[model samples]
Target chain A: MIYLDHNATTPVSPQVLQAMMPFFQERFGNASSFCRIGRIARTALEEARASVAACIHASPDEIVFTGSGTEADNLALRGVCRAFHGRKRHVVTSAIEHHAVLKTCEDLEEQGIAVTRLPVDCRGMVDPDQVKNSLTPHTVLISIMAANNETGVIQPIASISRIARSRGILFHTDAVQAFGKIPVSVDDLGIDLMTLSAHKIYGPKGIGALYVRKGSAMAPILTGGSHERGKRAGTENIAAIAGFAQAAELAEKHLAEEAVRLAALRDAFEKEVVQRIARARVNGRDAPRVPNTSSLSFASVDGESVLLHLDLKGICASTGSACATGSPEPSHVMRAMGLSPMDAQSTIRFSLGRDTSQGDLDFTVGVLADAISKLRHISSTA
Target chain B: MAKERGDRDDTGMSSAENEKAQPIQGPVLFYNDTVIDHFTNPRNVGEMEPGEANGYALVGDPACGDQMKLWIRVDSGRITDIRFKSFGCPGAIATSSMATCMARGKTLEEAAELTDDDVVRALGGIPEDKKHCSLLGIMALQKAIDDYLLGRMCAEEGDDLS
Candidate 1:
């Protein structure tokens, strides 16, 4: 099957799988133990941490491994809020954040914290000025995503981070969708905390990392063992961390070339689909988007039906966010982009990756065109 | 259009494929071309001025993010006209269209009783996941009828007042 849902998760790279195979058997020792096997595991884990840090231009001491991107986000948001308890309690974020951030903010709100969800423009972009304007004396942190998972619209993280710094407020970004596909340098972006997931970059699942800059105060969300420098407490996932490092290294090496190629394929797919289909709209067309993603809406066609039809044609794509799949509600990201409810429900997202080819793009455009035409015909008659 | 599975010939093709190819013979849980057509090309969309209509009502939940405004022209307590404006998915639009068709020329009491199941049946059947979309229209229709009755009662009271 041709997979166009790379934003959801990517297949594990061969090099990453190869690097991890040895740890599952030969070096299968607890990193906390005091044996030679344990020492080997500990060394491998620290090396992986360094590689992860290198990918994001962060120091090795700043990285904290977590179970998933969701866990990373939870740790970042909740940990910081708890650490700064009784001082400042207001948090600010964009309306188009992934549920990992949005829902975490909501949970914090239930605990009496004030959350200001800033809206986006028609192209799914949150202006840096809006972030500056929303700040208050009670505001403790500003969490925004580096790139939207659905529309691929890149936010002005560096500008927003600058605004936060000027106000003495901490800045965090959920970079799960941006880390491997785009260039992410924490220092350049002025980010205090960031989230990354392994599965999104062809690494193994159940492993992710949070970047907390040195001397940043953050309380632990999970407290058990003294792992991850007392920032995150749990037994280290040695094999997945090793695989994540290998994948991060490989992704960093080919990031530019793969981005250029995927951008070409994505442009071709969008152009062909728009030319062939009536009322086809590219969401976030006016914004600076990540090269590999495209979100399109076909008028009068239900997104779920389009997804099912595309799946029938052996093309795997998604309608709106993968996190909200199977729910009948339209995407919050599209809604925040000022799209009507019908327009939001009629949208689909196709995210290309390093392995996507010209032939795959051609097949996808042809199949999508046919499916839209068929669905439109059925709609017209009914 | 339910049929006994044992009576049908099964080749190597999967059951889902067979159901897609021949939709009339199986359980109507999945949609056929007829349902897709209504959902895609929904009918009687648009709106009438609120005060000019004999009855009208707007219904939706902001929490759910679905809303609809329905209007009906009543002549002697029978619906002489029906139209709807909905902000929702294709399923909701189709349900509104189907509700309009089902309510035209019916008495206010009859139209108010139109349930989501009735709307789904009129389209031959909607997918289980999308059944809620059909309910939005049903709720709107019921509210419109209630508005019509309340308006009539107010008019009678005005006559008493005068």
Candidate 2:
């Protein structure tokens, strides 16, 4: 099956699987122990940390491994908020952040911390000026995502960083969908804390990392024995961490070339969609976006129906449509982008990966032409 | 209309759709075979000509992302034919198709009594979250019956309603 839902998650690459196989079998030892086996585990863990750090231009000491991207986001928001309690009682973020950040901010609000959710534009980009305007004297953090998981619209991260840096507020970005698909440098963007998930970059699931800049006043969210230098607790996932390192290195190696390749494929695919289908349009067509995603909306057709038709034809894609993922509402990202509820439900997200080729996309466009034509014919609106 | 599968000549499904849906679909995800069959090969799947339909109704709100338009032709106080079109999910399409199948050839009084539960039960079962979708088609059919009754009264009163 052709997989165009890489934004949700990805399979572990063959290289990553091979690199992680040894740690699961012969090199199985807890990183905390200090004996010969443990020493080997510790060395491997640190090396993995260094590789993760190198991908984002951070030092090894600042890298703290977590269970998943959600954990890293929770760690950043809760850890920073809990550290500066009572003094800085407000946090600022965009409304279109992943639910990990959005829900954590909700919990922070429940604990009496004020949160200002900034609104994004119709293209799903959070205006840097609006973020600057939302900050109060008590605001201690500004968290925004580098790119949206649904629309793939890249936000104005460097500008937001300039604003947060001038205000002395710590900046955090959820880069789960941005890293490996695009260039993400902590120093280049001036990000204080960033979230990374290995699964999104073709590494194994259950491995994530948070980059905490040196001297950032962040307390540990998970409090236990001193793992991740007191930032996170629990025994390290050595095998997954090793796989994550290999994935990061591989992504960095092909980052530029794949970006060009995928952008060409996505653009050409969208061009054919406009030519062959009526009332079909790209959601973030004019916005600056990552190279691998296309959010297509077809008028007078349900996205779930299209997705099912594609699945039957051996093509795997996803949609923001309701009742498919058990959510009663369409995507919040679409709603925040000023899409009508009907338009929101009509959206289908196709995210390309390393394995996608022109032939696959060509076959997809042909099948898509048939699917949309059939559904529209069955619809009364047509 | 329930068990006479493959006998009706009006199922708008064609050979292309049958070939498209002929693959052995597993039940792990999405609907059962019955729902998928109706969705992929829906019966009475088109709309009626402008003046051919004596009764018509459109149900569901676009804000909810599920809508269905149904048309009915009545003859001598008996339902003769039914057709529908939907902008909805697989459950909406399948349930709409089944509702039309259940309504055709029944008397108007009998057709008006058709309920959402009957349509859903006939399909074995729909996913819990999608049970709401089954209501769209039945609601449309009931409203179409009302439209037919209303039009008959207007004609009887010598009021030429457009």
Candidate 3:
């Protein structure tokens, strides 16, 4: 019942739900159609675009809506890569990027484009110096995330973006986790291309947007009918798009206060965890991070087991490793930070949301203490 | 949904000692009722005192991230008592618990022959991904039996099982 996995996805807020309801019913006309109802749909779509663009300080015309954040990342990476296909193309990115960007980079490697994966430090930060050193004349794009989904560690995006800008390379950031937790201005951060997802920001799934700076040259990855200014092709999910814009507006309106409140709650939870449980440590504790996330590692215990025990107590959390689900791979972000396999698997992520409270954190820490000790006891003879 | 959120927020009871576990009213996700039952209230969750347990086995490695310590008190060539300590997820714990329950009184030969399939089947069925976890219990039990057989030979030569 205590939902602390906001980094995974957030429930659609009531206001966002309300905003989406009308589009799903009587007003379900295609935005591309030329009829009267279609004109209404087009107007609503443009308004939503403007709302999202305003939240991130980009022009509405620069935004192109996509199916999801993953698609947007693909659009940014592959669009540019495909445009410069058959050239001496290369990309620079960090090891701690989300799978959306990482896997896309991997796929690019298969297609003969070179990818330089920079490693993060123990604090889960990608150094700007490393980004600068990795760049070459062949490096056409540099993609780094604004914040990590697991550790919530904020990357030195502005510094890295500055490097890319000075070198005349396209810079892209997956801001799916960072959009609401931190201020994400495309111009201010010097991002030429960016990916944004709705589900992580308390909006409906299957709707996202990409910000392409004016004059940023890239080919359309999705080809067909002319939509999203011919950059992406598909009939838009009007309801989800409307919900996304409303969610972005909501996040902009309350960004400062909610960021402060969630950070307080997250820190209190972390402090209580370390005090009550032996060997309980926070991952990326020294890094500048987003406000709502806490990644904790309990030594000598497996994270999947702890997650199971917490689930029994009606507390929702996530583990870094997918071992329990038949995937033995621990988080690449954790591994890239030089944690032992066991340490990586022992990590858990707790992401706070609007509904989280001091009391909720108190109860969660209490449950966590129980789960940790029980698991440790199960492993150790006493 | 509202009621569940309210229950989580009823966290005003700040004292952990006073926090009574509200019985789970909803179906546990992924796992069936049987797996949930054994994991929630796992049986035989302890170690045998030294000199009392003749057979012991530890399966899985910490690097692999899941392990169990199982002990058996064999008598007259029949398993008289069994206990286990496990550091694993629900599937590992549940299947191990069920294995111990199934092996408590079985003869040494019968216990050693118990398969991972039997433990999994005993739990109704685990998820396809977690089906591999059942091997931890069955492997540990067979290893304990092997340890017992090895100890009897070494006991006549004056040695102890670690």
Candidate 4:
């Protein structure tokens, strides 16, 4: 079977699995303890932090381990919001944020914290000037994602960062989908806080990190232990973190070449689909996107039907986020990009990974053409 | 920031990644055994030809992602032949197939009086999200009967085009 849903999660690489084997059995010890094995675990934990930090150009001191990328995003949004609870309770974020950010903003709004969700253009891009106009004296944080998970549309982070910087507002980015696939740097973009995940980058699941720039006054979301320098309260998943660090190093080393390779595969997939199917179009065709993702809309065909057919043919893909699957509602991301609900329901996302090959794409092209043609024929003839 | 990743749900399990290598069987989740049977082997499918079918009706909105067409050949006020074509999920296909089975040998009056609940009962039951599929089947059959009656009325009342 050909797997193309890397944005959802990825298979752990052999290299990362090998690096994590020792921690799971022989060297299993809590990083907080002071015994020999514990000391070794502590040392390994710190080294992992430094490696993850280097991926985003942050210092080791700024990295904090969390159970998952969702936790890291929660820490960044709630942590910074709580820090300015009484002084500045307003936040600015884009409409196309992951539910982790969007739903958290909703919960904050329930608690009387005002949130302004800016709109994206047809290309799924947020205007920096819109961020400027949405800010008020109470706007303490501006959280925009580095890239959209569904459409893979890259946002204008640097310009938005400059706006927040000039206004003295802290900037946070949920870079879960962007970090491993592209070159992402917190320092270079002037980002104050960032979130990264391991599973999306060929690392083990249940491990992620948050980069809080030094001196960024963010309150701890979890409160109990002094773990993660008192910023988070749980014991770290040492094996997974070690795997994450190794994955980060590997991703950084191969970023340029992988970007070119995946982009060619994704572009070829999109072009072939658009040419074969009369009513098919790529969702964000004109926008800048990450190399590995292609969101295609097939008019009059249900996205779920396409996904199921592809799955039957041993080609695994997705109909937008897995969280929103099986719920008949159209994707909010597609709706935000000015597509009708019908069009949104007809969209599917195909995300490639390091293991995808030209032969796989060729097989997929044949499978996709058959599925769309069959579905369209059934739709029209019925 | 912690909130963004903490609630993330990316369960990306393809067939290759699935540890259990069992072949998929039975109906999809939310459908029953009978629905699966009808979906796998639909009954009375394909069209009856415009000249052969005295009544025909196409139901459902394409934008809603489901559409069905039913054709009937009536003789002596009884349905002699009923066929259907459906496009959508398994539920849609099952309901359309079941609807044809239910209306095959019934009289025009009986077929027109068939309700969505009757189709659901014939198919055991469908999912809540797909309850409309049953309704579309009954509606198409009723409309086909109506079309037949309308054509008969026009034939009897010559020069009454208005």
Candidate 5:
């Protein structure tokens, strides 16, 4: 089947799978043990840490592996907020953030921390100046995503990070969708903390990392053995980490070339779909989005029906977040972009990945146009 | 167990085409085979001319984004011809198709007595979330019968069903 939902998760690369196989079997010793086998595991773990750190231009000591990107996001927000719970209790974030960050901020508010959710433009981009103005003396952290998973609209992270730095506030970016698909440098962006997931970058699932720059103070959310330098607790998933390192290395090496290639494919698909389908338009058309995402809104057609039709044709796509599917709520991101409820429900997000090809794009556009017409035909008659 | 990362919990704000989901594999098992069959090949899917039908009704909930229109020809107080147009999910299409099929030759009173359960039973069973879809079809059919009776009682009932 043609898989165009890479933003949800990517298939693990063969290279990553090969790199991780040994850790799950022969090299099964815990990294913290004193035996020689344990030392081998420890060395491998540290090497993986360095590889992940290098992907984002960070130091090895700065990377803290976690169970998932959501956990990494939780650590960044909760950890930072807990550190300043008694002093500063204000946080700044964009309205279009993944639920990981948006919901975490809501939890923080329950603890008496005020949250300023900055709005995005119709193109789904957060203005850097708004980040600057939202800052207060009590603002301890400003968290924004590097790029939206749905719209793929790239945000001005460097500028936003600069604003947070000038005010002595911490900056965190959920770069799960951006890290592998685009170039992300913590040093260049002045990002104090960031979240990355391996599964999104063609690595093993269940392994993600939170990058905490040196000297950034934050408490740990998980309490257990003094693993991850006491910042996070739990025995590391060595196999997943090994695979994550391999994926990160490959992503960093081919980021520029793959981005250009995928952007071409995505743009071609968008152009054709819009041309062939009546009243169908691209979301975030003018924004500087990541190379792999195309969100389209077909007027007067229910996105769920279109998605079901696509699924029936051996195509997989989503109207909202994968988790939010089967739920009746409209996409919050589309609503935040000022789309009407009908328009929000009418959206479909197609994300390309390294595996996507021109043939796949052609097939998608052909099937998509057919589905839209079918749905619109039923709608107009009804 | 390996922590599955790629199965990202895209809670909100992100969207993907979900082919991996079991339900999308084939008519989501929440709907039975009959519902699937009818939804896949919905019957009587076109609108009838307003002048051709003796009674017509349109019912919709703007909040639910579901709407149904039913047209019925009352000859000798029996629904001789029936057609429906629906805009919603698979269940919406299936229920309306089933409703029209069930109402085709029934007397006006018999059609009016049809409930959401009758539609569900005819389609085997609908998913719980789709129970309302069956209700929509039944409500539209009942309203059409009511419209037919009201038009006969009025001296100046026009051809406009709206």
Candidate 6:
């Protein structure tokens, strides 16, 4: 099957898989043990951490490995909230954040910590001014995603981080969607904390890391076992960690060239769809988006139906956000972008990957055009 | 999964064209051309003057991301005119049109009792997922009628107060 939903998850590259294979087999000793095999594993694990750290221009000691990006987000938010237990009880975030950050904020709110959700403009971008305005004396943490998973709109993290810095607020970014697809330097962005998932960047699932700058005050979210500097409790999944490091290194190395190619393919696909089909348009067209994603709306056609049609035609795509696909509600991202409910419900996202080629783009456009025409005809007759 | 049921020739139209050419061999049931006509070319769309309406109701929620503004002119307790502006899907627009058709000339009680299933039936059965859109329209119509009744009762109460 032609996989166009790489933003959701990607296939593990052969190099990454090769790097991880030994840890899962002969080198299967626990990194925490003191034996010879264990020391070997521990050294490999630390090296992997350094590689991951290098990908984002962060110090090796600052990276804390976790099971998933969601865990990293939870560790960042709740950990910071716990650290600021008495002094600051407020957190600020954007409306278009992924569930990892949004739900973490919600849980914090439920725990009596005041939370402010900043809204985005029509381009799905939150202004740095809004982030500044939403801050309170009690505001301790500001979490905004570097890139939207659905619309692919890149947020102004550097500017927002500067605003947070001026107020002495700690800034965290969920860079799960931005890490491999774009250049994410923690130092350049002035981020105190950041989240990255392995699966989204061609690494294995269930392994991710949160970059917490040294000297940043953050309490542990998980108790027991002093793994990950007592921040996350679980023993490391060493194989996945090694794979994640390899993938990150590859991504960082090829970021510039891959971005240009993917952007051209994404633009070409979107242009063909809009030009060939009537009433088809791109979502967040005016926004600065990631290179590999195109969320297109086909007017008067049901997005779910279109997705099904595309699936039948051997083309894979997503209707709205992958997390909220089974839910009948239209995408909150599109709705927040000032689209009508119809427009929001009729939008499908095509996220290309490193492996996507011109032939794939051609097939996708042909299939999508046929599907939209068929659905529109059915809708008209029905 | 819905099956792709025909072959495409070099012209991109083949047995499918023949399938379309063949006469549909079924009774004219719920969608007997009338519903299709109304759905294809919806009527009474666009905005209405707010105060000029006999009754109006703005229903649905922004949180739900779908809203419908329904208006009606009730003459002597009968719906004389009906119109709606929906910020929803095609299913919603079709349902709104169907609801307006069902409400015209109907008594307030009858219109209030109109169920979402009734609107779906008028459209020859909407897909299960889109059934909520029809329900939204039905609820909006009921709310508008209830608003009209409440307004009349309030006017009577004001007369007694005077």
Considering every candidate listed, which one attains the maximal DockQ? 2
> A364, model 2: CA deviation in Å?
0.6
Off by over 4 Å in 1: A380-382, B1-162
Error of 1 at A101 (Å): 0.6
- Per-residue CA lDDT of model 3 for B77-134, tens digit only, reads 9998889988777788888888888788889988878788777666666777676678
Model 5 alpha-carbon miss at residue A153, Å: 0.6
Q: Pick the lDDT winner.
A: 2
Q: What overall lDDT, based on C-alpha atoms, would model 1 receive against the true structure?
A: 0.84
- What TM-score do all the candidates reach, one by one? 0.78, 0.91, 0.90, 0.84, 0.89, 0.74
Q: What's the lDDT for all of these models?
A: 0.84, 0.88, 0.85, 0.85, 0.85, 0.83
**Candidates sorted by DockQ, descending order?**
2, 3, 5, 4, 1, 6
Candidate 4, DockQ score (0 to 1): 0.18
lDDT of 6 at A300: 68
Clash pairs of candidate 3? none
> How much of the true A–B contact set does each candidate keep?
0.07, 0.68, 0.50, 0.18, 0.25, 0.05
Model 2 spans > 4 angstroms off? A321-324, B1-29, B61-63, B154-162
Instruction: Write candidate 2's Cα lDDT for A276-305 as tens digits.
Output: 988888887889999999999898888888
Candidate maximizing TM-score: 2
Please rank every candidate by TM-score, starting with the best.
2, 3, 5, 4, 1, 6
Better of 2 and 4 by TM-score: 2
The docking quality of candidate 3, as DockQ, is 0.33
Per-prediction backbone clash count: 5, 0, 0, 21, 9, 0
Ranking 3 against 6 by DockQ, winner: 3
What is the alpha-carbon lDDT for the whole of candidate 4? 0.85
lDDT of 4 at B135: 73
Clashing pairs in model 2?
none
Query: For model 1, what share of native contacts is present?
Result: 0.07
